[model samples]
Target: MDQLLAQLPPSVVALLDKWDSNVLLITIASFLAWLVWKVIYNRLEILTQKTRFHWDDLILASVSAPISALIWCWPATISLGFILEDYTQSKLDWLSTLKLMLVIGIFVWITMRLVTNIEDYALTQKNRDETTVQAVAKVARLFFIVIGALTIMQSFGLSLSGLLTFGGVGGLIVGLAAKDLLSNFFGGLMIYFDRPFKVGDWVRSPDREIEGTVERIGWRMTIIRTFDKRPLYVPNSVFSSIVVENPSRMLNRRIYETIGVRYDDSQQVSLIVEDIRSMLESHPDIDAKQTLIVNFNGFGPSSLNIMVYTFTKTVNWVRYHKVKQDVLLKIMQIIDNREAQIAFPTQTIKLDLENAGEFAGMQPQTEHQQ
Candidate 1:
């Protein structure tokens, strides 16, 4: 390589000397980085497909670029060292500082990748909730970021004592300015511990009139995907303030109905009520252990009212509806077999000939008829 450069023209040789070491090192580093990245990344991708454990693949994917850069940093620093000795003192100092910063950047990048992958791993655990996992991961990331910043500052020979003192005062101002943000942050923490609802659980807030499946629990907001598929970003603080109903926790679904029989068929009310009660008790879908009430509740103006109160074994909305429908159909069949009728609101008024004279006397007489 040296002989090849020697054979070149004098001007070309001078130009070559200007860029020789740095250029050669960088080219070699880039080639090696590419080769390593391709080989390792492809192998990991194959392994990821073959195995159930995916965290390795995720970590590799996330850190690949940073690892390549870190590899290049070695050659870069060596190249920069050659320039430092030959260049102006100021330029040498700047390059040295830049190289240090580059090293710190790579460290921070790798740390972030590791933290993210760990968080993702936590999410895969059957016992862990998505909201809690996310919160922990975010806190870990923030911690690393703060540490990285402080490390970079310390590398630059900056005093943290003064910064810490200033931060104490500044933090107070920042806390006051971002009170709502702080409140939400703490609210999210409370949710993590309290666990009122989790991701994928259906929840509704009676006060806010919001009902949806929890999509994600973020640091400041909890994302809910409504039944209509609209994304609702609710502040974590709002959850702490309101009553949230998590229907997903229900063991059974309720079915309460009022069926009125016609006054004329009131004689069969006792038999009808007993049959209905027996049907509910023997039904496959109705929960036998739960409350099952069937009785002649009251008499309305036009009918005798029977109240049927029961619970379905299944808590699933669709299945509960199907069970309720089946029960209602069976009830209708029972009523029809007994020669009974379901009643609707109706009214009756009787007029007598003895009362006709008063209405006739109240009518105004026409002039031509008179």
Candidate 2:
């Protein structure tokens, strides 16, 4: 690189040094680097578009400017150091450290940018979960940042061995002081790995009153959008201790309801049950492969209870309700066709032999009082 710089024409060097314009040199170098990176990135972008994979595009895009900046920085810093040493007769000792830090920072920035691009691309895929992609990206960024920080510290003459020992002790103390916060963070990691539920899932806990659609799952807490439209903030650690039911993952929505018919319609019970079973089996929305039970559940005081247990093909809430409504209406129509009605409570009154005469005498008086 020094040889290449020396190979420059005397005319150009003289032009640059006429007014000792170091700022102009840096500006011109920056512009040339930008133009070169722009051209390289454009070419890489076209090539990536032709390739079968997309990740290469992300890598190329992420590394382009950072690499160009690195290329520009090496010579720029060396030139500045030379220029300053000639004028001041001493080198800026910290300039070397600054360059080291800059290199480390640029690499970290590149990795983090690449992670972000991958995260966004994953989100664009229909099957990818937004929460999982974001979590993975965050972990990647954190890893790069930690590495960069340690590298920078090493550049500054800090002993990594001493730092590690101090960090271990300090980490232990911090852990003991913030147990709950750490627990929540680990719980979040567990959530990401186990995937009991993700953002936008309908999760309900039998152990606690946490029933809602998960809006956001963070390191410390999860934000739930309850059915009542209120936001419920739950610590992630609570999920570790409780049982969460993810209704969104269910393949079929169950329709378990007990329909009642008048006792007078007992003769029609067999036909009604058979017809309901047939209707559910042939229904497009119902999943016949699942448990489809339609039978007389019990004998009520005034009506006969017929339990219908079945599953719908769709797990969507709105569509499930519509299907349930249609099934119920069909059942009602079948009952009406059989000349049977939905039963209502009824009672019959009777009088004893001794009270008959008293009632006969009181009947006229009660009627007159009314």
Candidate 3:
């Protein structure tokens, strides 16, 4: 083997000289690393299928690319020393800094992957909504990226004290410049922790005349999709400023209506009122636990008003509407069966000839008198 190497071309001999046993060692190490990764991945895949905790599989999948990159890059980086032996120490130091930076980058990548996996797992557990989980994950990723950047800077022999001082001053300036933005960000954090309303929750801000389903909660704003299907982007600060009504949180929806009966049906009004109350009490959808009131409120200009105040067992809009319609229809049927009539706005005017002396004087004489 030595004689054959010597018989090679001069350039080839020099190249072989630079490429020493370390190259072979690096290749073997890289292969072993790859093999280990493959074995672990396959085992995790099988385990995930059998285990209840499937998040482990997700985590493995997320880190697979980064692990592969690290495995290959580590070996190549080790071989760089043998290849660049004739290079200056300063150039080699740069390479070392680059390698450190790559290591920090890989750490950040892994951290981000873990954050994503954790977010996904939390979502499946229903502990938080999609928007909230994503926001939290992004915040975590930002934290890891900042730490990774600081680590890379430190690896390059950069002082963090000066950088921290600069950052402090710069942060203050940015805070002052973007006061509203900062307020919104903190407001979003408040919403996240307080959980006033989540995605898909029906919310209405009476002060702002905003009523919609929460689609997403971002760093600075919350997106609402209105009933008309228009997208509304409201700042998080606005939510803090306004009164937000989350109707989705209500256990039951309310139904308050006034039914009018004609004055002629006054005798049957009491019976009608009692029957209506009975109907509400017996209705399956009506929430019996809530205050249910049926009373003869007062006499209106056109009719006698009967007040029906009750709550349904459902908070769903469509279901509530259906219940309300059915109740109203049943009330109408009861009134019809009792031979009663609903009142309408009407007016009556009368003319008395005896009281119209001025009009009588202006009228023409009868034919016989003429």
Instruction: Score residue 236 of candidate 2 by CA lDDT.
Output: 92
> Candidate 2 lDDT, tens digit per residue, 134-162?
78888998899999999999999999999
lDDT of each: 0.86, 0.89, 0.87
lDDT of 1 by residue, 1-370 (tens): 9889888999878766655466674666567777977797888788888877776777777788797877777676767677676665444555667778888888889878887888877878888878777777888889988988998888788889988999999999999999999999998888888999988999999899799999988889899999999999999999888999999999999999999999999889999999999999999999989999999999899989999999999999998999999999999989998999899899989888897987677565543367
Candidate 1, which ten residues in sequence have the lowest lDDT sum?
361-370
Candidate 2 runs further than 4 Å off: 1-23, 64-89, 351-358, 362-370
lDDT of 3 by residue, 194-296 (tens): 9899889999987997999999998899999999999999999998888999999998899999999999899999999999999999999998889999999
Rank by lDDT (best first): 2, 3, 1
Ranking by TM-score: 2, 3, 1
Candidate number of the best lDDT: 2
Candidate 3 backbone clash number:
0
Q: Which stretches of candidate 3 lie over 4 Å from their true place?
A: 1-36, 79-91, 127-132, 351-362, 365-370
> What is the C-alpha local distance difference test score of candidate 2?
0.89
